[model samples]
Target: MKPRTLAGTCVPLCLLTAALNAAWAQDVPPGVGSESASRAGGNRLDRVELNSRQQSDTELRRKSQVAKQIYGRDELDKYGDTSVADVLKRLPGVNVAGGAPRMRGLGAGYTLILINGDPAPPGFQLDQLNPAQVERIEVTKGPTADKSAQAVAGAINIILKDAPRVSQRDLRLGLGYNVDRPTPSATFTLGEKLGPVSVSVPVSVFEWRSLNESVTERYAKGTDGQPSSITQQGEVLNWGHGFNTAPRISWRRNDDETLNFQGFAQKGQWNNRVRYNNSLPVGMPNPEDDADNKGSWRMLRGNLQYNNRFSDSQSIELKAGIQDARGTFNNLNLRSGLPRVHSVGDNQDRSLTQAGKYSQLLGEDHSLAVGWDLEWRKRDETRTTTLANGQNQLPDFDGEPFGARIERQAFFVQDEWEVSPQWSTYLGLRYERIATSSRGGSESVRNVSSVLTPLWHINYKLDPKGRDMIRASLTRSYKAPDLGALLSRYALNGKYPDSSVTNEELSPDRVGNPLLKPELATGLDIAYEKYMNGGGMFSVGLFHRRITNLIRNAVTLETPSFASAPRWVSRPVNFSRAQTSGLELELKGRANELMPALFDPKTALNLRGSVSFYHSRVDALEGPDNRLDGQQPWSGNLGLDYRFSSMPLLVGGNLNFTPGYTTRQTQGQWLDQSRSRSIDLFAQWIFNPKASMRLSVGNFAPLDGQSVTRLSAGDFTRTERSGRSWVGLGLELKL
Candidate 1:
């Protein structure tokens, strides 16, 4: 699909001029270490700087609130993790549902991500960022008036490193190995100060490979539930590669005004191959099928933003970005030395966004913020199916040439006020409008919707020393149905009747419904926090949500759309109500301080952990249920870190676990999944001031896992087992 005409062409011109003006405004003195730091001296300086920064936790504590957790550079470096997703997994109330991270067990769409307080560009992937580029990460569990009110799960803000005030450059190279192949990565960054302007450019490349295996079992209808068929066995291999580049420029016209510009570009490619062998029941009259499938995808995204600060507490920001992504998938099924089917698909997606925000301090105790944003998205897909020797071609599915266009607009206003010396409050309002149109061959559909939301938050300091605080909030949020799920013109059916078909499945025959409405939610939050000395903190929070118009899949049997066979049709229908509530406890501090008598201060040890207990009740099409579609009941993480005072070494490990939750399909198929656990360990050695190496073990135990799905109608069941594990050793260098 091709996006609308670019609107950012003129924006860069304005920012470029500001950059030039700021550069001419400043008159800086001679370089401090730009000329003196040779390779040897640079190494020494790098070590000292890293150590100094690791000891500072003031930034994290300073920016945190009662319902938020902030992880800074020191926390990020503790485990030698590579991706933002990896670090978030160890945080409280976070779960890796599938390809994306979910907060409080909410779906990916319900969880919002922002870059520097601005909505992230479409198609943005968290794993694309290298830890070196991030200055801090903030996880907000409740709605805040100054930001968008679309988060049903919560919000995550990623703050990138700013341009350095002085001239410096770094080059890093790393090599490692996993279960499948060698992994290699590299990064380079350059920062320079030109008079009154400062600029930084960073580029990185990384690659990884994986090996996985799975086994499946299927049983036919029987009185005793004895297995009538052992369905299939499968093996899979995957490899992925990614590259990224980001450049920033900041210029200060004076103490009262400043301008900054940042640009980002990233590309990634993934490849997967799968092999499966199927078994046939005696005299079943069906041929035994052995299948081989392979797929690959490549994605590209770019974004840019400009910010102008008029004074210490007032500023205006403008941002414009574009995303273009395309990929293809192909599958060929064979049986008895004959090609039974060949299917191929080519898909493309493109999006563009333009946004602006204005903020000013009304006085010492009050401030106001307003913003407007607009976005356009489009997707195009084409599929072809050839049966038996390429001589027979099945007619294109109902929506063969599928295409869609979606446009959305939002405006918001917020006010922050201090009602008293120890009390503060925030009030905000937001309006949103969305329009979408889709077409497939001769069929076309369009829809439009709008909404208004209001929110409020209050905070109180219960102690004069500011060591104890309480927070409460009541807000409104919503989750819009996925564009693809609402506009896709046709149904894509999976290959059935060959393996576990009789055992009942959530048939992949998905077709979009044009009448879907967004799910609306009213939420409440309350929390108390105790700030300890040495930047430590202990907190407990409670949250609740009441949601309506819940969207879920509804299946129908014997649909004419697919030759009188069962169809897993997805129609957005409203549900009565769903309620969710959860409790969170977080503790982070030095062990010596928490338990002075049990630990020695000389050990230099710290502890960090969180526990979350949550549950939800929803009226499903099948019946009453206690779980929302993607949410888990409970989750937790624990980690311990020790810094050796005698040497430049740091070692840490973490354990994250979640108990599996089960659910029922609209068609009466029940799915039960087993618990999941992940363990990671890391050891880092700062060999020189500029050089370091890390050894990491991820999913170290190779834990066995299983899941079962049962169909009451057919009295059939299917089970699958798999394992995940890997290890890596990496080296870092700076210049």
Candidate 2:
């Protein structure tokens, strides 16, 4: 969340920027030389060790059979002031407005979240996760057929680290505080080696607060492309806490195979407060729609797997998992303390997935990999509210209102074939079967669906370890209708012509229409990467794709016969098609200290940056006027880092720059002034092996960072999103 006080926001932002400019002053991995480094490999019984880069959290999350995804992590500190939303914004193709994370330049409804490889979005998902305990984050940077049948843009997967190992007992504590927020966290790992048996378990607790002051709007429409928004300014705060625990037990059954079992549990909760004052008439001077948002979720999961090495050239592993989750949302709309307004709702979800993968070593120049995936899921929800005393709040369009339920199942498989020492090829296929039903609740629509897909990838190595190489892929994918599409109430403008009632059940709406085909996509991509001997790398790529059955929202009107309600119609319809393609380039590496290039073992310099340019054209938009959508025509980030390890303590800083781009700015929902660009800076110091500190500042001058919008007489514009500058400080200890 953005800070509240003017000084609080400006002061820290400046400090951070300054730090970034003077970076190249810090340290590297702790204890790499003195501490014993375990050799990476598996024991005869399948016990394995992973190197730092191989087990990176970033790559893990992006691993959907296909579709590219990315992520970033915020280092923990003594001043534990970290926001999940804030960290998410530093990632690619992700931005948050009004506390909602938009992925692939799309809305919330399109992206999906997963927990430890499971498809699940628990309440407090964004607010309550403990950043300190996150081992790493990953993204699927490509496309795959077996990934999903419903992923319109693509897929994202998050893999949590396996339980830590313990010999006796160990405890970890972290505490941090910024002028505006505080963080408290604890973690403990325990383990013991008994004869031939080894057991390990890790537990963590985290709590933090997020607060921001501002006003935001959802969407703005029309040809001019303005933003949509109005001032109902206020202060908001969120307090979140959560924990995770998992245990691992393993036995060396034999020389050829090993068995392992894991039990895990996770829980999170967050409370939010939003107060706004809208401008209006006396009776509605400012609608006081204060809401107390409280959410909680719980999960119990287990994993069992067996590994077998039949020979030196091949190996196979079989694994299965089971999970159960229930979520609760108690939302109350109010117009003051007088009476509860219009909404009270609750939801619950459950799912299970199982699969098996195999790897075969074919001589010294080749290898093969293949796998199959399967999953099933169900959900339920209940909503209760009062409209105008006598009118009912909801019952979906078909007239049922208790809740909604659904079942989805999918299966997929693929193979990776290595053709030679420098070349590799991949191919895959996936299929899904889905059935859904609803009654009395917003999710009530019964529909059945299925999809088939084929995908492939080819890689060439120009240099060793894939340092200089090119990769190309072709993929076909699809997305099915979600809950909102089949269940919303379709309507017409109440103004004049044919202003009539339009129920979602109307034939044109396809409420229960099972004939609706899935959204399909075809894409071609080419990428090249090169390693610069100086510890950095450069990469560039180009891609193009076509999408059919794309769902979109458009305005529909009748001849002054519509009902006395709202005008616009919001539903799922496969209107026009979309063609998108772009160019991406990235350069990152350690700065050289020697070639006037100051390079040293004690103090090191690093440079990292990426740029993206996309050309999107709309051929068949349902709207009368045809034009391109407004995302960014060109955007990217560049950072420079400096670190010094010579002192008893280590210090370093980094600067990040992102130039702004303009869209056809709209009004109302997304009104805002044009911001040319933005930048942030930071510096960090390690007091010792066990202690560290960080300072961050953002948006100095020329900072037309537009995050706030305003509504004028008719044309809407916006104030700079970021103020002059803001500063933040943090500290951390490993004891």
Candidate 3:
């Protein structure tokens, strides 16, 4: 538990280290047959993770944060964040890649989101996650057969704070600003502990406006044609707002029985307006066409879990939850005298997910644990577009759009066995039955099938020094296509019109075979950790994964366009192979916590952080030799903070830099032209244990025209990083 005036690193280093060391010395790190006596602090902070160990685990350059591996809690509290994407960007080895992210070469459909390790409803976009209620985020990299057969892209577990153990309570309020936008954001949270039960509720709201401007020059035809058009520039305005709320409850009825639950709900919306204040080509609108779009998304989630004891060495556990998601986006583009185009998008998802987990202590020397999970979900999505007299984005275009739906059901179970005091092994299996259903008079489609997944893990302790240990795991995984990818079609006027969308007879864009096989990957990961006799810590590891049936949307340029259809268009195709590989390293330690009381107030402070280095390659692609856009190869995060018992205030910050890395090169070079190096800096000051403030600046080292900017005016669509620029401010509060 946090003190009235919080101070010290997030975790209790000394105690956690001792607990683990004691267990390691006895050949029982974590499993059955291990003594049940609590050795030290394991659970305390609500928004941070603590190792509890002082020696620290040094196996790779990448040190898992206080939260879970992959995804963690530090993202939310490190700064008062408003969007989920903003928080995910700071994670190591992860690059936003502009729109979203392609984890280990896996697409969005393969990645699944869970609140407290339970599957969320379908149709939910990653960008819509609410940051306010998140206590921490754990990313389970690589395949997991039981959690979600669809976890080929990895798993994101969002851990919400359970009610505190005290009857007392705490609250927080915050606001932030951006130069180009006048949007104001605020957050409030209250936590209370009442004997055997605890509860916490948090609410947040934000309203913002932004401006976007761009300039482009017309390049003549192949023969250095006549002077085409002078430099052209356009301006856009965007407005957006969002709402989020979370409620958590925890009950520890005595010591042997306990219950924990966390629920979240959110609503987000954005409006975009564009104005090309310039002239058009031949027979185009004078002041150029104008377009506006309105979009909104809402999500609701709940998690419930309970544990009880029947006797001294006997116990049972059960956990269950559900998630509902729905959203709509509308875009209208047209000019005064040109044919109008109207595009609307909508999606609704409902799911009933539950699981039964059990653990039984079998005798004094042997124990066994097993669990089962069940999930059923469905989603409906539709996109429509038509051409009127004039469209804001385009002048002439006539077409109608379509809709589609997908339904799925999955079940999984696993068991852990204690081979002996010096070693343990885990083995598990899971199965999923995916049924994709389609509607709207568009040839109903269905993918009714089942797949089997398996996993294995082993651990060993080589020495009593508690420094030498080895862990390894092998998991088989699968990725299923969503309803949108297989059966959804929208009339993208200029991009894809009647020529763009048609009957499934022809493979659609961004998808391989309508009956495409699930992508497969086998992961092999082994790591070793050791604590030096004296001080420092170091970790390094190597990783590689191969993916198959990679999906990509290919342009059908030479393929003649339908007479009544538009000019150019595209469709989906299967790319034979896609591979990803990389190496990682992380090192940290207390250079010296006690330096003979250097200052007046108290003992000397401690300092430390980690550095990661890696490279990624698309390996193979069947597309028109396009550059993997918006991806950086060499990127790293370095943080150094100090706590003071002397001064009334503390100062600290982190520096993150990413050298420009183009995953792949595009044909026209739009991505390459905008490609360049960029870095961000952040610093915080704690006036007292009760109040603190921080400033985060991105593109702080921006040069020329390389900075961060939202291209879609009000939406999250970022065109590219702009020139040297920054945004900063301060925060203050009292517990």
How many steric overlaps are in each model, in order? 0, 99, 44
TM-scores, one per candidate: 0.85, 0.73, 0.75
lDDT against the true structure, each candidate: 0.68, 0.51, 0.51
Query: Better model by TM-score, 2 or 3?
Result: 3
Q: Pick the candidate with the highest TM-score.
A: 1
Question: Model 2 over residues 418-508: C-alpha lDDT tens digits?
Answer: 6766777777777666666555433335667666677788778886465577878787766565543443333221111122333221112
> What tens-digit string does per-residue lDDT give for candidate 3 at 1-735?
111111121122233345435534554322223233211211121002222233222322123211124334434655545556666665544445433544433345555666666665654444544465676666655555447766664666666665655543344443333334335566667778777788888776767555555653332211132223333455566688887777888888878998988777888888988765444442321222467779998888787888898788767778777778888888776565344567776777777666765666666544455566665666666555555633322222122223444444555555555566546566667766666555443345555666777776665656644455565667667666655556434233332333433312122223223454566666665656444543444445455556566555554434332234323334454544555445555544443432324532222233344444443344453343232333344456565444432222233455555554333322222232334444544444443345555555544444433322221112111233234333434354545
- lDDT tens per residue, model 1, 1-735: 111112222233344346434532452222223444233343344345533453354334433433577778777766666677777788777876544778887778788788877666555668767877888888887656556666887888888879899886777666545544567887788899999899999888988776666676656532132434556666666777888877888888876556677777777666665566666552232222445555544455555666677687888877777777676677666665567777778777788888888999998888899998788988888777676656323364522778887798989898888877678888889888888788776678888888677888788889765577888888888887766776555444434422213212334455677667788889999988877665567888899999888777665543433344443444555645687889988887778766789986544677878889888877654454446766777888888876654344567888888787786645476667778788888777666556666766677564566687666655444445555555555666677
C-alpha-based local distance difference test score of model 1: 0.68
Model 2 lDDT, full chain set: 0.51
lDDT of 3: 0.51
Q: What order do candidates take by TM-score, descending?
A: 1, 3, 2
